[model samples]
Target chain A: MITQRAANIAFNILVIVAAVFFALEAETFQTSGLLASTGLPSKFFPQLMLAFIGLCSVIVIGAYVFRGFAGTDKGASVFEDGGAARRGLLVLAVAVACYLVWSLWSFIPMLILIGPACALAMGVRSPWMYVSLLVMSGIVYLVFTQLLNVQLT
Target chain B: MFAGFDVVAQSIGQLAEPITLALLVGGIVLGLIIGVLPGLGPPIAIALALPFTFHLEPIAAIILLLGIYSAAIYGGSISAIAVGIPGTGAAIATVQDGNKMFKAGKGGEALGLSLTGSIIGGLFSVICLAFIAPILATVAIKFGPREFLAISVFGLVVVVRVAGESLSKGLLVGALGIFLTTWGLDELNGTERYTFGSYHLYEGIPLVPFLVGVFAVSEVLIGAERALQKLDFDQTSLTVKLPGWGKLMKMKDVLFRSSALGTVIGIIPGEGAAVAAFFAYSEAKRRSKTPEKFGTGHDEGIVAPETANNATVGGALVPTLTLGVPGSPAAAVLLGAFLIHGLAPGPKLFAERPDMMYAIFIGLFIINILMMVIGLMAIRFAAKLIQVPTTFIVPTVLLLSFVGIFSVSHSFFNVGVLLGAGILGYVVRKLGYSIAPLSIGFVLGPILENSLRQSLVIADGSVGEFFNTPIGLGIYAALALTIFGGPLAGWVKNKMFQRAEDA
Candidate 1:
C-alpha cells in the first residue's frame, strides 16, 4: 500500500546510512607486508564510490521530501495490489527456500521441490500445473546431470 | 578491412561444419522461442544458453550465442505484434503500431514488415561492423589506461542517464555495482578489499552467475506476480506477408536512417537495442510527413523500430569486440561468454585471432539472412509461446537459472551468489529502477577502478594529466556534451515557447 514516494525516501535514507557505514569500514582496508606501499590504497575506489553513492542518495531523499516523488513516477503504488505483493514476496521466499533446501540437503530434493514450490507460491491450485512443473524439473535434471553430465552437486 | 585469405578460409571451414551450422539454426530457433515469451529478453536467453556452450568449439559456441543474441532481438517483434505485450524491451516500441496493425486485420503485414525491417537492419549493421571494427581495433590498440578510463566513464554515464528518470537512483545503483567489484584481492596491489573471510570470494563475484540472477531470476520473481493470468492472442491472421520492392522503396529513407541511427547508438557503450528502437521510432515520427499515422499502424512505424533494434546487434558488437567494453546489456552478458571460453574481447583479440573475428562478422551476416527464412517459418510456433502461462514460465526459468549457475561451477557458493544478486535485482526493479545501468556498471567496474588508479600513478596524481591524450580529451568533451546537451536544448526550447506565447 506504500506509494513510491514513501518507498524512495525510505530506500534512499537507508542507502545513505549504508554508504556512510561502508565508507567508515573502508578505513580498515590496508595492504600489509610488501604490498603496503603499492600505488593507491585498496580503499580508494570503494570509498570514492561510497561517497558518490551517499551524495546521490541524499539528493534522492531530498527530492522525495520536497516534491513527493524521487523521479517522474509520481505518487505511484509500489505493487499493483495486495495480491500482487503477496505473490511476489512469496515467490521470492520460495526461491530462497529452494536455495536453502539445496544447501541443507542436496540438489535432488531442491530440484524436485523448486518448481512445485514456486507454482504454489504463485497460488496455482491446479494439480495439472504442479504435475507439469515436476515433469519440467525432471527434464532439467536429465539435461544437466545425465545428458550434459554437469554433476549439479 | 578484409583479413588474410587463410583466416577467412579457416573461419568459413569452421562455420561450414555440420555441428556449427546446426547450433546456429538451433540457437535462432531457441532464441525465437524464448523471445516470444514475455518477460525474457536477449540477455536472459543468452545467459540461460551459456552453460550448454561448454562442450562446443570456441567459434561454434560464440556463433551459437550470437545467433541467440541476434535472433532474440528480432524474435521480440513476433509477440509484440501479436499479443500487444512485448517479448523484449527492444520490441516495446514495435508494440504500439504492431498491435494496432494486427487488430486491424493486417497482422501478417505487420509481422512481415517487422521481419523485413529487422533483417535489413541486421544486415546493414553487420556490413558496418565489418568495415568499421578493424579500423577501430587498430586505433584502440594504441589506447592507454587513460583512454580506457574515459570509455568506462562514458559508458557508465550514458547508461545512468538513459536507464531511468531519476538521476539519483540510477547513480546510487551504478555506484553500488562498481562498489561490489571492490571485493576480492586488488589486481594493482595484492590487497584484499571485501572478501569477507571467504576463500571463494577472493576472486570476487562471478559475472555469469550475477548477470543470470539479475536478468533471469528477477524476471521470474516479477512474472510470478501475475502468473495466474493466461495470455491469449488471435491465432488467425498470423501469416507473414512481406512487403514488395514497391512498398519497400517508399520507406527506404526510414530504413536507412534508422539503421544508421541504430548503429551509431549501438557503438556508444551502454546504449542498447531498446534505446535505439525508441530513439529511431521517435525520429521517424518527427520526420514523417504523416506523423499522425504513427502509433496507428503505419508501415514505417513498424519498420523503423524493428530495423533499429536489430541493427543494434552489429553496432553493439563493434565496441565489445574491439574495445572489450560491452555496447549493450546483452553484449555485457555476451562478454561473460567470451570470458568463459578463455577469450578476452578487446583489440588484442582481433590481432591474435583474425579467424575468430572474421568468423563473427561472417557468421552474423549469415544469421541475418537466415533469420528471414527461419523467422517466417517459426512465426506460428513463436506466437503460441505468447500464450503460455506465466506460472509455467516462472518455475521453468527459475529452475533453469538455478541449475544453469550450478552447472557453470559445482560450487554452492556461486549458486548462492546468483540468488543474492537475483534478490537485489528484484528489489531495485520493483522500486522502479532499471537494471541496465547496474549491469553495465558491474561490467565496467574493474576497468574503471584499474584505469583510474593506473592513470593516477602515470599522471603523478595530477587530474589534468588523465585527459592529456587527444582521444581521452575528445571522449571527455563528448561525454560533457551528452550530459549537458539535453538540458540546454530543452531550456532553449522552453524559452522559445514562452516568447512565442508572450508575443
Candidate 2:
C-alpha cells in the first residue's frame, strides 16, 4: 500500500533522473549534410521534450513533498491492498515470462503455459476454469495457425 | 457532395460478399462481448482484431473493425444498467439511474431505452461523420506543417487538461510519450539517435504492438488485480423492451442534444466517449424540467449517456479518417488498422481511396443497424457476459496480445516491446496517472515532431512566421481559448461575487 505522496515523490525523482540521462544522450546525436545546418538539429526536439518532462517532474515532486498530496485525494494508496499488489505484480511477471519462453523456445510452449501461469498468479482454485482457459488458448492457436496462415514459430 | 455516388454504391455492393458480411456480424458480436466485460473497451477490441485483418482486403478489414467500434460503446450500457457496474468508462454516467431502474424492476425498460437511444445517437453521428469528414478533408488538404503543428499541440494540450486531476502528471506522461518517439533513426536527418545497435529500433517502436500494450495489456494487468471481484446480476430481467414511438417522441430533445454534444466532443481530438457521456448526462440533467428525478430511476439519465457514448464512435472517427489525428484512444487503434492496410489516414486517404472511404462510412451505418438486431438478441445473454471472471480474461488477452503482435511481424523484438510497454503502462496507471495523454501523445508524436521541425525549417529563424498562416492562427486562437477561457471566466465571476458582497 504505497501512498500517493510517497509514490509521486519517488516516481518524479526517477523521472527527473531519466530525463537528465536522455538529455545528456541527446548531445551525442550526429547529423550530416545540408540538414545539419538546417533550422534545428535532431537533438533539439528530444532535448526540448526532456526539459519539459523534467520541469513537470519537478512540479509533481514539489507538490507531493510540500503539499503532502498530489491533488484532490489526501492520502490515497496506489494499490487497494497487498493482495492486489501481489496479484498485479505476479501477473505481470507471468506475462514477461511467457514472452521470454516464446523468444527462447517457441510459441506453442509459451501459449500452453500462459493461461495456467496467469491463473496461478491470480490464485484460482477451480480446475474447470483452468481447463476452459487452456481450451480457449488452443482455439486461438488453431485459428491463427490454420485459418490466418500465420507461422507461429 | 454526392459526387462519389458511384463509388459509394460499389462499396456498399461489396458488403454483399458472404465473408465480409460474416466478418461484419462477428465484429459486432465480439465488440458487444468485449464492451459487456467491465475492464475491456473499444480500443482493446480494435487492437486485438487488428492482426487478424492483415490478410483480408482493406475494405473487409476496415468494415470488421468499424463494426466492433460502433457496437462496443453501445454494449457498455448493458452492464451499467443490469449490474450497477459500467462495462466501459463511457457507461459511467448510466450507472446511477440505470441500476436504480433495474432495482425498481424496470430492467427491461431501462435496457430498451439505452438500446434505442444508442442506435439513434449512433446513426446521427454516422450521418454527421459522413457529411462532415469529406468537407473537413477538402479543407485540410491545404494544411502546411505549421497548421498541423498547431492542431497537434491543441490535441495534446486538450488531452492533458481532461485526462487527469494533476496537470503536471498528465504533461509529464504526454512529454514522455513524445520523448519515447525520438528513439531510433531521426526522420529528418536519418541520423541514428537511440537505436542502440539494434536494427529493430530503426523504425522506432512499432505502433500496433505499443498501442496494444498500452490498451490491452495494461488492462490485463489491471484486471488481474481485481480478479477476485465477482459479479451478481439478474439474468431474468435482462430482456430488452423497446419503448413505443410516443415515448421516444417525448424524449426526442434529449436524444438530439446528447447526440450532437457527443459528435462535437468526438470531433475534438482526445476528448473521447467517456467525456462526452459525462457531459451529455450533466447537460440533460441541467436542462430537465424535473432535475430532482435524475439518479432515481429516471429514463432520461439512461438515455443521455447511452446515446452520447454510442454517438462518439462516429464523432471520434471524423478526425481519425479525415485528418489522421485520432479523436479518441479507440480511434487511435483504428488508425493502426488503416496503416496496416498500407493506407495512410488523413485527407489524402479520402482522395486516394474514395471506395474504401465510402466503404467505412457505409460499413459503419450497416454495423449500427445490425447492432440493433444483434443487441436485441444479445441483451438477454449480457448478464452472463458481464459475469466473466477477470481471472480468465487476464491470461487469454495477454496471450492474444503476445501471439497477435508476434504473428504480425514474426519479430520477438515487438513481443518484447509489447511486454515492456504493458509494464510501463501498468506502473504509471497504478501511480494514478491517466494513460490517455500517454497514448494520444504517442499517436501524435511523429506528427508533432515532423511538423515542428518542418515548420521551423520553413520559417528559418523567424519564430513569428509560425503564426502567419490563417489556419495556424485560427488553431492557436482555439488553443488559447481552451487553456485560458475557463480560468479567465472564473476570475471574472469571482470579482463580480466579491463586488456583490461589498455592496
Candidate 3:
C-alpha cells in the first residue's frame, strides 16, 4: 500500500522530472518565415506552463515531505488495498492489450476478445457475465456499423 | 424577440418529424438508464452518444442530446432515492434524505417530490435560458481578445479554486491540461511545436476522444476495481406518486429558490450541477425551521437538490451556447457535439443559426415536460437497472468506448490518445484530484492562448493596458471576489464567534 504522502512525494518527483524534460524540449522548438516574427515564440506558453507545473510539483513535494501529509487526506493509500490495486492495474493492462490488438491486427478480433479480457482482469467467475458482455459488444458493433455506417477497421 | 416566433414555429415544426420525435424519446430513455447506473453521468452519456449523432440531422442531434442532458440529471435522483448510492455526482445530495425516505416506506412520496422538483427546476431554467442566452450573446458579441482572456482566466481560476481541497493540485492539472493542448502546430503562426513528424499530431489531441477517455473510460476502469460489489433493494417503492397542486404550492418557495440558485451557479463558467446541488442542499438546511429534519427523510431535502441539479442543465447551457465556454463537464462534451457538426458555439451561432438556437430552446422545454412523463413511468424499470452488476458494465463500457472512438476518425492514434487520457484521468482522480479543472482547462486552452497572445500584441507589452477594457476589469473583479469571498466570510464568522465568546 502506497500511502498518499509517499505517493505525493513520488508523483511530484515524477512531475518535476517530466516538467524539466519538457521545458528542455521546449528549447528545441523552432519556427521560421513570417511566423518567427510573431508576438510570442512558439515555446513561450508551453515553457511557462511547464514552469508553473514544476513549481506546483515542488510545493506539493515540500508539503508532503515536511508535514507528512498533503492538506486533503491525512494518510490514505493511493489504492484501497492490494486487491484493488491488482484489479485496477490488470484492467488497465487489459485495455492496453485490447488497444494493441486492434492496432496490430483488426477491430473485430479486438472487439471479440476485449470483453472476456476485461472480465478476466476483474476476476469474474460467472460464465453468464462473459456471454452478456460478448452480446453487448456485438450489439455495439452492429449499431455503429449498420446504423451509423462507421467503417470500423 | 417576438419577431422570432416564426422561426420558433418552424423549429417546433421540424421537431414534430417522426424521426426527431423518436430520437428525442430514445435519448431520454438512454439518459435515464445511464443515469440510474452509478459511475455514469450526463457527460458520459452524452460522450457515448456523440458518435451516433454524426449521422443525425443537426437539429435532431442537438435535440436528442438535449433530451439526454435534462433527463440524465433528473434520472440520477432515482438511484439516489431508491438506494443510498448516487447515480451521478449531481445526485449526491439527494442520497441523504431520499434514501432515508425510501427506507421509511415513503419512497413513493420521495420519488414524486424529486420528479416534480426536477421538472419544475428544469422548466424554469429553460425559460431563463430562452430569455437570458440571447441577451448574453448580444453582449458577448462585442468582447475583444482582452475580454476573452479575462473570462478564460476567471474560468480557469474559479474551476481550480472550487475543484478540490488542494489548490496546487488543481492548478497543476489545469496547467497540464492546457499544456497538452499546446502540442499541435500553433494556430496563429502555423508553427509546429510538438508534432514529432506525425500528421495526426498536427491537429493536437482530439477533443471528443480525450473527453470520452477522461470521463467514461477512466470511470470504467475505476468501476472495475469494485466489480464484485452487489446491490439488492426493494422494488416496491420505486413507483412515483407526484405531488398534488397544494403540495407543490407548499414547496413552491423551495423549488423557486433552488432553481434560481442553480441557474446562477450554472451561469458561472466552471461551477457545475454537483456544486449547485450541494449548495442548494446546505441552503435549504440553513433556512429551514427544522434544520434537524433535513437528513431524516425531509421532503424539502429531496426537492432542493433534485431541483437544483436539474435546473443546472439549462443554466449551464447559458455559458455554453452564448460564450462557447462550457458551463459544466457535461456541457463540455456537448460542446464537442457542436464542434462535430462543424458549428462553433458562441455569439455567432445565434446570428448564423437562429433556427438551430430556437430548436434547442424549444426542444429543451419539450424535453423537460417529457422527462416528467417518462420519469414517472420508467422509475420502476430504472430501479431494476440499478442491480445490474459492475462486471457487465465494465467490459461493455470499455467495448463501447473502443468502437465509438474508432468510428469517429478511423485512426488508431485517436484510440491511443483516448487510452492515454483515460490512464491520466484515473491516476489523478484516484489521488483525490478533481478532473474538473483539467477538463475545463483543456476546453479553455485555445481561447486562453489565442486571447493572451492577441492581448499582448495589442497592448504592446504595457501591463497597465491589459486592464483597459471595462469588460475585462469587471471580469477580473468577479474573479477576485470568487477567489477571496469564502475565506473572507470564514474570517468574519470567526471574528463574530470570538466576540460572542468575549461577551
Candidate 4:
C-alpha cells in the first residue's frame, strides 16, 4: 500500500508545477489604461489564484512532512492489485482508442469501437454479453440517427 | 404574478402533450436504472442524458432531466436496502438501518418505508422550491456586483468546506477548476487569456462536454477496475408494503421535521442531499425515545434519512434555478443543461421567462407525485435493473456519452475535451479528492470572476468598501463563524472533558 505521505508529496509537486505554469502564462496579459482603470486588471484574479494554489501546495507539503499522513485508512492505492490496475488501464486505453477511431473515420467507427473495446477490457468470456452490447450500441445508433435525425458525419 | 398566469397556463399546456408525458415516465424509469447500478449516481445519469436532450423542446428536455434527478436519488435507496453498498453518496446514511432491516428478514418493510419517505421528502422540497425560488429571485433582482460577489464567495467557501476533510485540498482543487475556465478570450477586453491561437479554444472549454467527461468517463474508468467482481445477493421476498395513512399520520411530525430540515440544508450552498440525510438521521436519533434502535433497523431511522435525502432534491434546485449557483454537484450538471438551452438562470430569468419557471414548478410537482406511482410499479423492475451486467452497461454508456457529446457541438475537439476532463477527474478522484468542489467551482467560475471584477470597480479599489454592504458583511461573518466556530467549539469541548475527567 502507498503511504498517504508519499501521495500528498506527489500531489503537492503536481500542484506546484501547475501553479508555476499558470503564473508564467498570466505574464502575457498587458495591464494598462482602461484595463487598469477598471480597478483591477484581467490577470489579477488568475495570478491571485495561482499564488494561492502555490501557497497551499507548500502548506500541504509541510504538513505531510511533519504530520506524515492524515487519513491512512482511506488512503489505499488505486491499484490495489495487479489485475485491477491492468483492467483499469485497459479500459482507459480503449477510450483513447475509440477517440482515435472517431478522429480518423467518424462517429460510425467510434460506435463500432465501443462494444469490442469494452468487452475486451472487461475480460468478458461470455459471447452473450458481447451480443447484448452490440444490440445496445445499434439501438443507440438508431435513436440518434433515425429518430433525432442527427447526421453523424 | 397573477397577470402572468396565462403564460404559465400555456407552458403547462405544452407539457401536457402525450409525447412529453411519455418522456417523463421514460426518464424516471431510466433514471432509476442508472441510480440502482452501483457507482452510477445522479450526476452520471444527468451527464449521460445531456446529449439526448439536444433535440427536445425546452419544457420536455427539462422535465426529462428533472424526472431523472428526482428518481435517481430515490433509486439509490433500493441498492442500499438490498445490499450494504450504497448506490449513491446520498444513500450512504440509509444503509445502516435499511440494510439491518433487510438482514432481519424485513426487507419488504424497509423498502416500503424508504419509498414512502422519499416521496414525502421529495414533495415537501418541491413545494419549498416553488415557494422559495420566486421570493429569492425577487430579492436577487436588487443585487449589485458587490452582493453577487459576496454570494459567489459564500458558495465557493461553503463548498470547499463541505466537500473534503482537508480544507486546503478542497480549495486547491476548486482553484484549479476556476483557473481552467480562464482559457478563452477575455469577454471584457477581447484579449486572449490562454487561447493558444486555436479557434476552438476561443470559446474556452465547452461546459457540456467537459461535464460529461468529468462525471461519466471518470466513472467508466473506475468501473473498469472492479467490473469482474460479481455482486452476490439473495432476493428471498421482494414484496413492498407501503405504509397506510394511519401509520404515516403517527409519524407525521418526524416526516414534516425531517423534510423541513432537509430543505433548509439544501438551500445552503454546499451541503447537499447526503449531508441533509445524515444530519436528519442524527437528529432523529438524538430526539428518539430509544436512540439505541437506530442502527438496529428501526422504522424511524429509515424514514428520517430517506425522507431528508429525497427532499434535498427540491432544496438543491432553489439556488440552481433562482441564483444560477447549483446547491449540489447534480444540480451543477443540470445547470449545464439550462445553459445548453440558452437559459441563463438568475433574477432576470423570472422576469424574462415566467413560462420556464412555471414549467419547472409544475413539472417538479408532477415528477414527485408520479414518482410515488411509478416507484411502486417499477420497484420490482427497478430491482431487476441492478442485475444488468456491467459488460453491457459499460459499452452502452460510453457510446451514449460519445454520441451525446458529439451531437451537442458536432465537433471532435469537444469530444477530445470530454476525454481530457474524464482523465483529469479520474486521476483526482483516485487521489482522494472529491469532485464536488471542482464541479461546483467550474459552474461558479464565471460568476465568481465577473462579480469580483465588477465589485472591485464599484468599490473604487477600496477593500473596506467591498465589505461595506450589510448583506455581504453578514454572509462573510456567517461563513467565518461556520469555519472557525467548529474547531473552537471542539477545543472547548475537549478541555471541558479533560477537566471533568480530572475531577
Model 1 chain B, poorest ten-residue lDDT window?
B460-469
Candidate 3 on B1-503: residue-level lDDT in tens? 33277888898899999999999999999999999999899999999898778888999998999888887888888888887899999999999999999999999999999999999899999999999999999999999999999888988888888889998889999998899999998998888877888999999999999999999999998998898889888888877889899988987888999999999888898888999999999999998889999999999999999999988999999989998998888998999999989999998899898989988988899898999889888889988999999988988888888788888788889889999999999989888788998899899999999899899889997888877899999999988888888899999999999999999
Q: Across residues B126-209, which tens digit of lDDT does each residue of candidate 1 receive?
A: 999999999999999999999999999999999999999988899889888888888898898878777778999889999999
Docking class of 3: medium
Candidate 1 vs candidate 2: the lDDT winner is 1
Clashing pairs in 3: none
Quote the positional error of residue B394 for candidate 3 in Å.
Answer: 0.6
> Which lDDT tens digits does candidate 2 get at residues B1-503?
45467987898888888899999999999999999999788999999989899889989998999898888888888889999888888999999999999999999999999999999999999999999999999999999999899889988999899999989999999998888888989887788888878999998988899899999999999999989999887777877899999999999999999999999999999889999999999999999999999999999999999899989989999989888998998998999888978999999888888888888888888898999999999878765888889998999899989888888888899989888888889889988888999989999999999999999888877878866789989888988998899999999999999999999
Q: Pull out the clashing pairs in model 1.
A: none
Minimum summed lDDT over a 10-residue window in model 2 chain B is located at B1-10
Q: Residue B117, candidate 4: how far off, in angstroms? A: 0.6
Cα-based lDDT for every prediction:
0.91, 0.90, 0.90, 0.84
User: Runs in model 4 with CA error above 4 Å?
Assistant: A1-4, A30-39, A72-75, B1-3, B491-503
> What TM-score does chain A of each model score against the native chain A?
0.95, 0.97, 0.96, 0.85
Per-residue accuracy of model 4 over B1-503 as CA lDDT, tens digit each: 33277987887898899989998898899888888988899999999998889888888998999999989988998888887778888999999999999888988888899999998999999888988899999888888877877777788888888887877778888887787887787766665777777899987888888888889998888888888877756587457889889989988888998999999888887678889999999999999889999999889888998899988888988888888889888999999999999999888888888888888888888888898898888887787666777777777777788888988888899999999999989887877677888888888888888888778777786889877899878878888887899999999999999999999
Residue B272, model 3: Cα distance from true site in angstroms: 0.6
Which candidate wins on DockQ?
Answer: 2
lDDT of 3 at B314: 92
Q: Which stretches of candidate 2 lie over 4 Å from their true place?
A: B497-503
